[model samples]
Target: MKAWQHLQREPGSAVADPDVLQVINACAPRPSPTLMRINGRVVIAYSRTRAFIDRDAWEALPSDGLLLLRVWPRGTSSSWFALTRPELERTFDEVRKTRSWNSVRHYHFRVFPAALEAFRVCMTRDEAPFASQISAAEAGSESEKRGSPVSPSH
Candidate 1:
């Protein structure tokens, strides 16, 4: 991003206190630390089909807060949609545009607050993000079991 480019240009200069929000894309190998100058926290992740698993971790940040979108720009892109230069400039806005009736993916990973224990409780060093898609199917089954009057849109 522009901020990283700016910082890269001035390697010796004292970087400002971080005000960052991090985003790790799907199938990412790892989160990049260079993009995390603002707020100085990492938020590498993949969103589940129906939810942002880390939602409560940063529920209070605004859409435009600083972000470190950790997507692949080399080789095959790990993100469902790789961001272009113009899109990165307005990533939050562009990501919000991806919102729809059943989609939970977007580039709106701005705001890097200190890590929350609640957010880490379910995850461990060995577990992978989202873990699996069985939950999505389970949700549908549960809905059927409840016999809700309105059917799911999907």
Candidate 2:
């Protein structure tokens, strides 16, 4: 069975969105995205869905790669997760460190097949600048922040 099939059978099985599934399929090495909602706000958007895996599965995978995790609020729409290279040894460790994770009740990790070297380069050269831009825009004004939605936790 596909990983997604197994996910659907899990205890909290929420239907993965079609768009999310498409992105996951098109993006090599990344797991299918998981959808979730928190409080009343949609903190995490649909594009940020992620897959969850057990520790054993995580450890068995290749060492050099990117992993994406999605976290959601208990009753709101806001949620987020980390996408990092060099598989996270402990998902909870990083989650606990984030402000949004403080109130999160649901989450999953999505592993990506990427070389550590490439991932590092991408993060430093690509993602870092993009993140800075978003931060700057968000800091500039409430209107801009509201207009530019943050990616879902993952």
- TM-score for each predicted model, relative to the true structure: 0.21, 0.25
Model 1, span 5-112: residue lDDT tens: 111111111112112111221133223112221243332223222212222222322333322223334454332221222323332232334453127423333332
Q: Which one is best on TM-score?
A: 2
List runs of model 2 lying over 4 Å from the truth: 1-53, 85-87, 90-154
Residue 35 lDDT in candidate 2: 25
> Mind giving the per-residue lDDT tens digits that candidate 2 earns over 1-154?
2222211111111123232233333432223332222232221122233333333223322343223333333455422223322324422344334444444433344443111111121212223323443344456631111113223433
lDDT of each: 0.25, 0.29
What is the Cα-based TM-score of model 1?
0.21
Candidate 2, residue 119: Cα displacement in angstroms equals 13
